[model samples]
Target: MKRFVVCKTCGARVSGLLDSPVALDFITKAEQELLSGGEYGNGDNGNVYISTSDKHHLSYHQDQNRLIGCCGPSPYGLPNLVCICKSEIGREVTDCCTAHYVMLYKERIAIREDNTGLLEKVVSLPVAEDLKSQYEILINFGEIEIVLNALKM
Candidate 1:
């Protein structure tokens, strides 16, 4: 079977034969132990970012339709993401602590049923003053870490 990245804008399969999709969903350090795939955000555009620092990193969309998977970093001073990576890859500063993705559903990631898939969930991010307080707690004390989030599809 072959794999390709479909443009949400044009619905085009943007991949060549070099595309090799990973079959496992990775976990990050900060999210809760139990999670599920769902919608999360401020009712606008949303993104999902995850970590597998132990192995790899993955990005997708909460829309349960879009995807943004990484193809590992570059070595030739270029990149090899090959498909959707073109749009989302360089968007991040090479050293930025965060990863970027379109955030999609579980079936899209296609984790195997044997080793267990990465769990995901959605939560409302409070607004105004409450949002500010939460931001303070989240960014304070050098506690910056990865969060697997659900966003508005």
Candidate 2:
């Protein structure tokens, strides 16, 4: 069974499940300043870091336009890869940056299951019941937890 990170608004595949997400602490001075005031930036926000070697998992927009801080030879800045619906999904940390990482916006992306069992279970459920109850059942007894646990590793 495989899973993927998808754009919540347009269902565009952002990346496959990260085999091993790495922690990054290599923000540049300019980026640090931008992170303080950019649209997706917030001082206290947390970021999911993926390696550049895993670039194959990510898909970029055809426009090739760079973001505010992402320009020049080093271009250590992030790229402007928006969803088909025009929503900013995630950013690719260019190789120029000291850390080879891709920072994804967690709130804008969803984890989707590619397995049949879970999809079958979801499709069989009645639509009348509250979604909360359905989610509870799925989390407590279905294969979702197993998949989630595997991602944690």
Candidate 3:
């Protein structure tokens, strides 16, 4: 199975995952937007919901993808990603600026624009019971270094 993660804040070169998720939380909107075309400053201005895959990406790092905008970017922007992970997890992800990531109460679904430029639900992630796990999963820099070395890149 393929796994996805944002770059680590620690000294790790890149972020990878285990068969079990190491991250207790999802990636942040600020990071997600950066992954999308929402660059920090104008090389890029604000509100360019356009998708660009040609942006420079680090080895083993795919900054952007099409047909699947992950659980992050949307035509509505990351600030609007409030309440994503919309699985009733009750983990309150306030990063969406309370814009409701899952509008109409559907988060994991993909909202695509048609030829007429109307956004609609093309597809969505299946609703599943949000697994509540015990114990903490921490990714220390030293552990990350080991994992980075294990990767092909």
**Best candidate (score: TM-score):** 2
* Candidate 2 residue 114 C-alpha distance from true site, Å: 3.9
Give the per-residue lDDT digits (tens) of candidate 3, residues 1-153.
322222222111111211221211123443332222221111122111111231111221122331123443343322222122222111111133221121111222211212211111111113321210000011221243333243322
- Residue 89, model 1: lDDT of 28
Give the distance in Å from residue 98's predicted Cα in candidate 3 to where it truly belongs: 21
Q: List the residue pairs that clash in candidate 3.
A: 82-96, 109-124
Report the lDDT tens digits of candidate 1 across residue range 39-145.
11110223222222111222321232122223322112322222233333211111222232223222122221111111111112445644433443343223334
* The 10-residue segment with the lowest total lDDT in model 1: 114-123
User: How close is every model to the real structure, measured as TM-score?
Assistant: 0.19, 0.43, 0.16
Give the lDDT of residue 50 in candidate 3: 16
- Looking at model 3, which ten-residue stretch has the lowest summed lDDT? 129-138
Better of 1 and 3 by TM-score: 1
Per-residue alpha-carbon lDDT of candidate 2 for residues 1-153, written as tens digits (9 for 90 to 100):
444456778665555333322233465533332221111221135544444343322456565545433332133444455665677666765433343345667787765555544433433356543553344345435557754453342
* Quality of model 2 by C-alpha lDDT: 0.47
**Full-model lDDT for every candidate:** 0.25, 0.47, 0.21
Best by lDDT: 2
Which regions of candidate 2 are displaced past 4 Å?
Answer: 20-44, 53-79, 95-97, 115-153
